[model samples]
Target: MQADIQLLLTADGSHTVRHETLGVTYHSIHGAVQESQRVFIELGLQAAFERFANVPLRVFEMGFGTGLNALLTAREAERHGRPVAYTGVEAYPLPPEESQKLNFDVALGTTFLNALHASPWHETVNISPFFTLNKQQTSLQNWQTNERFHLVYYDAFAPSAQPELWEPEIFQRLACFLLPGGLLTTYCSKSYVQRNLRAAGFTVEKHPGPARKREVLRAISPPIL
Candidate 1:
């Protein structure tokens, strides 16, 4: 089925698009520009990178909508002088032309906007020495990789919108992609989602959600053998 996309102004004064079928929302709030910096860049990614305190950090994101998460992550990696290797998966690919019209730079800053535009579409593209963003235009169901990730941003649609993606099998697949002691964070606070993650072998926790959100989910895997 074709996805229904519409643009709307969010409370944060950012432009956001809602994917009706997936019941997913994308911040056109400069598109990924806002989401990347706020959700992952400042909160999740930086915290993980600091705890790791390593030269290079590896990140994997389940939903790459608007590429906001990738752009923000690249900016953070550059600021810390740490190299970041990122892999993102998205089922519906947006064209570069449409992406450029997002105006994410005005709010996210010109540098981040340019870096985001420079990221290539339809392939794994390296934007800078410290950051690399790769995208796969396919659903998570088709996802297969042996690479282990240190951090995962679980941004899939809500269970009500895409029940299959939120199933135990999908969470199990996510567990397979993580390195020992890896962590997963999401904006969702659904008990069923937490239960699924636990069933898939993750140590799940409920955390304070972002602004206006009541709760969120954080999951971690034990150290690898």
Candidate 2:
């Protein structure tokens, strides 16, 4: 089902899309860019870099949405001279008219935001020397791939809005694609979600969230026996 969406300015002056039907915002209401940087970038990608070093990172994102996380990750890859193979899955993509209004290009000081959205789905496109993107137009439930990932940006709509995506079975399914010691980060800290991740064989941790959010989750796939 398509959502009736509207772009709204968040507290940190970044733009986020709100689904009127689901009553949920794409990113935190606090600050889209700030939350993305903290949860996905600092805690997710950077943390993975510490363990993996300069090796090319295979990153998988659950929901592409506004492409903010991908944009930031691409920029980070460029800054650090690291290689990143990024894949984002979005069942319902935002049209160009809607995505164009986001101010992330100005906020991040890069014009590649448009190129990100323009790239064709289900095909790998080299956004830059350090960043390669594959935008998949499918739901995580239906999308299948043999390639494992080093990091997963689980930016799905909140559990309250999309309960199916956060269930234990789903976590178990996604865990299959995570390399041993791989990391998955999300701006959600619900107790049941943590339990679900644990049940799916992940070691979970809670970190300080960005902006007004108090806490977020970071889960790591256990090393192979």
TM-score of each: 0.87, 0.98
Instruction: Output the lDDT of residue 134, model 1.
Output: 77
Please state the error at residue 210 of candidate 2 in Å. Answer: 1.0
Q: What is the lDDT of candidate 1?
A: 0.72
**What lDDT does the true structure give each of the candidates?**
0.72, 0.92
Q: Write the per-residue lDDT of candidate 2 for residues 2-118, one digit (tens) a residue.
A: 558999998888899999999999988888999999999999999998988958999999999999999999999999999999999999999889998999999879878999999
Write candidate 1's Cα lDDT for 1-225 as tens digits.
234676666655655667777666664233334444545655578767866776577899988776667767776787788888889988876655556665555666645655554566556677888888777768889877888888898887666777888888988888889887777888776888888988999998776655656666778876752
Q: Please list all clashing residue pairs in model 2, or write none if there are none.
A: none
TM-score of 2: 0.98
